[model samples]
Target: MGVEITTHVLDSPRHRTSYLSAGPPDGPLMFFVHGFPGLGAMWRPQLDHFAERGWHCVAPDMRGYGGSSVPTGAAAYAVAEVVDDMVELHDALGGRAAVWVGHDWGSEVVWSMAVRHAERCRAVVSLTVPYIPGGLTLEHLTPLVDRSLYPVEVFPLGQWEYMQLAIDEPELVAEEFAADLEATFAVVFRGGDPMTLGTPSFTSIVRAQGGWFGPSRRAPKMDRDETVLSEELLDTLVRAYGKTGFLGPHRWYANAGEELRAGRPGPGDSRVRPPVLFVHASWDPACETVTSRLAEPMREACDDLTEVVIDAGHWVALEKPGDVNAGIADWLGKTLRTGPHPM
Candidate 1:
């Protein structure tokens, strides 16, 4: 069934946000943040599920993507700025802190909020992306690199080559990518096989092969594989991203400087001492479990943290909505002392 959806645009540095809300009144607020190449609508499944449970579900089209303002400069898309926008959004909704949940880059922003603005977040759920402390940067993560998949010689820049492509020519990259949003979405969201970790690094293949879809730059047919993302859903994403282009979302990578990338504890670091939950995507390529090490630091930073592993791609909410909803409901019941509402 379709969920009640309400969305607004909040002006940030480069772009505005299409913030969508769902659920019943006086219910616990659950804030959602979408990842790269995704808009707030990505959480439709979760919104539908949670709203039935009488919870206020919110998903924002973070900084540069969707209906939000698309600022020209990369500096505007920093994690800090994104976090601040969320904080303001939460305040505007009500004074109370909501159950914060983020996916992909949005997950990174949620991590920042949990660390820097604990008071604003009652609980935290991060999908795909894990919390890396201030010290861990792309450089630091290089050592943990599975050399088998990504040979240092060829993929020296690691997964960063994609970022380079986006940063070097935002408009061209967007235009080139805009030609076939469906193909791009399909190719981009396709999760990597875990077994391949021991073989050639997929990141390397994409880089060495000159882009993800090979030299052609054309995305393949939209095949419903393990992702479970429906054609209607895929079309929604295509339309939203196709209109805005990826420049704003791509700029998020460039905006995250050493300070945000490092993830150093700022003034509000200790504030996220509440019950937190992290849903790790077993097959997420970007924040690959077998490749990227996120579990360790998350445990260290969050005094009360719950971790769940879902056999899905980076789009965990859509891929495993039942599991995701169950996890959230279970945590809310135990911690927030609430029960799921009937649809």
Candidate 2:
């Protein structure tokens, strides 16, 4: 059976925001947040899968993406504001504490929700990015670096370099990259192997290489990895992103601040009291887990957390939807056998 779908557009002056909801109004709800340079539609596959299995899935365009309200002020994109939107969204749906899932920047937002507004999340599933409790600032993130992969002196900037580029030339970066959205999506979403780890930081290459696509102004052709994402699926993504210039979505990075950038829980900081799940992308070179040491600290922080490793790259949900869905289903079975009550 097809799931029911509804969407809302919020206008915040800077941009138009769109959030799509699927499945029955009364079904268990799951909020899916997308990462940088992506819109709510990035969660299409997961939303389709979960909605069919009695989940009311909601995917938002976030503050600056799609039809959502986008305020020009960077402060509007703070973690607190994003978390507030989730809470308000839940209340609008006649429910509270939906199973929250995020990927990339979305993962950061979901992490903040669990930490700052634990009461509003029944459970959380974060993909790619892990929970870094503390203030979400670049200054606070220095200690969490795996020194071997990212040396202090040369790479102190780390991912900040990429962020800086985006912030400095948001329009140029968006227009240049979005010129061929297909090639851009393919290169960015191309799955890496589980064997490659501790490679030189990509952040270091940004200024010299001119962003993640390397020296090329446009993305080069990438080999199709059918095992991870099908050609048709890839085509759909290309079309979606192509139609929506990345400026609205990419700006979310500039919108975030030092606190949100840190992503680590702080002393006396709010803990994620709700049941949380983290699905590690085993082959994600950027957030590698072959070291084990990388995820160990996160496991120790949450009171109720579940960790599952999927043999996929940064795009875990897209690369291994079955495993992702199953991991989430298993968690839901154990945690939400009885559906959530209306708030």
Candidate 3:
């Protein structure tokens, strides 16, 4: 909060972007993009840290989450379109190929940028979610499931069942989360446990259980996980989801299978040519990467790659900000020092 971060807006015929700006305007540019159920403010800790290090930081509320434009349909939240939004935001921020850092679904967008617009990137850093080569659709992910834990007979899609729920019953999923944003955040943002790495994730049973809260179709009442969420962030999330509802966030995953089949993101578009840093959230069962095949595509495709494992949950950035920051900072420092630069 000491870094004097300011909010700004950009409006165009197609969309609107509301972003938080910190550090000197002319300093080395870096962008932090948030994913589903997140706002620009989710990156406040990151923005402040990097800004203090003399890096101009910008974190934008991607398409459906905060002050940004909330388009009505799922197609509007596609990777190509979302990348276009970032392209515009990047251009607006002086057209510098920045060091782009992202999390969750944001990583998908960042990877797409590396594929489609490599020239606009100085480097790419992704936390929790790894680069999925083509895209993060179930098609690519289903094959990568740890079959020993998620057998084909029962857990067809493994930990991604909740995504299937979102894709199948989008409105209901949204309404359930929107019904009690506080409780929703409380359950969703809990810290990860390394003990449960081999165990099945709760997300695997969402469809069979008849939604996130089982038959109740609402989030169960629980105290917020202070280890993963601060009161300010919880309140900000409640307020934001209260205004926008969860539909827009869910929409981001809608039609994902079809989109991949149509080659909008091109499953074959796998090679990544930027200095990449992937943070493995060892305790995060859902986005499990350390022991799973999920990260193989990224490793094979990215010629310049660095990997670090953090013992935190899917909310790795919030659960262990120091580790996440240090990982990225180390990667950046190494990248800059070994100059073939223009990542």
The C-alpha RMSD of each candidate to the native structure, in angstroms, is 3.4, 3.7, 2.2
The predicted structure with the larger TM-score, 1 or 3, is 3
lDDT of 2 at 11: 47
Q: Can you write out model 2's per-residue Cα lDDT over 1-343, one digit (the tens) per residue?
A: 4455677765443334478888776777789998776668767778878888777888987766656665665567666677667666766677566788999888888888887677778888888777766544454455666777776776765645676677777776787678777777666766667566657646555755666676567778777766656776677567666556677566666655434445534555756678888888877866665464556556767888878888888888877888888888877778765665221
How much is 180 displaced in model 1, in angstroms?
0.9
Ranking by TM-score: 3, 1, 2
- Per-residue CA lDDT of model 1 for 318-338, tens digit only, reads 777889889878876777654
Per-prediction TM-score: 0.86, 0.85, 0.95
Give me the displacement of residue 48 in model 3, in angstroms. 1.0
Q: What does the lDDT come to for candidate 1?
A: 0.70
lDDT value, residue 287 of candidate 2:
67
Worst window of 10 by summed lDDT in candidate 3: 256-265
Question: Model 1, residue 85: displacement in angstroms?
Answer: 1.5
Largest TM-score belongs to which candidate? Answer: 3
lDDT of 3 at 107: 88
lDDT tens digits by residue: candidate 3, 83-150: 88999999988997788999988888888888878888889999888877756888789999999999
lDDT of 2: 0.71
